[model samples]
Target: MKKLTRLEKYHMNKVSQRSNGKVVAITPEAMEIEQRAIEREKRGHYRVAARLWLQCMDVASGEVERARIAIRRQQCITWSNHTRQGEYSGIGCRGVVYD
Candidate 1:
């Protein structure tokens, strides 16, 4: 089992509190997939990470909190596709055009 980060633990605690004390434990397999997704993101494999995040969202059913995850996954996909197509130039990157 991977150790949860303080942020992760804090999020879990918030979820539990929001759910009126119902513990929302993620399955080990889901945890493994999420870890892999994080690794992919760290490696600059944004598309793969986005797909893995979608898989994680699927596994995390029955909650409105999953909406946040879905939005983030969509953002990853959008950014990854834009970057792959050479259409994205934001804040600090090279070739950014400020208006």
Candidate 2:
């Protein structure tokens, strides 16, 4: 079993405290999946990362957190599709050039 990272431990504690210890325990498998999803995101495999993130969301105990993850996953998919089609153009908010 993979040891939990500091961030993961913190997240687990926060969720537990919020739910008064009623939520499911954070399993090593879920952490492993999250790690893999992060790796995929870093490698620009956004579709794969989004899918893995959805899996993580499914295993997450909090409805609000799951919704947040779903939104993030959708954003990843949108960005990935746009980037692949050369539609990003390095533009930031208010038409500012980021690069």
**Best candidate, lDDT-wise?**
2
Question: Can you tell me which runs of candidate 1 are displaced by over 4 Å?
Answer: 1-28, 85-99
How many residue pairs collide in each prediction? 0, 0
Lowest lDDT 10-residue stretch of candidate 2? 16-25
Clashing pairs in 2: none
lDDT of 2 by residue, 1-99 (tens): 577799976775565223433222254555667778878988999999899988987787655556556666786799788666535546454566664
lDDT of candidate 1 over 1-99, digit per residue (tens): 578899987765465323432222265555667778877877888899899878887787445446555665776787787665545667776875887
**What residue pairs clash in candidate 1, if any at all?**
none
CA RMSD of all predictions: 10.9, 10.7
lDDT of 2 at 71: 66
Q: Which runs in model 2 stand beyond 4 Å of their true positions?
A: 1-28, 85-99
At residue 43, candidate 1 shows an lDDT of: 88
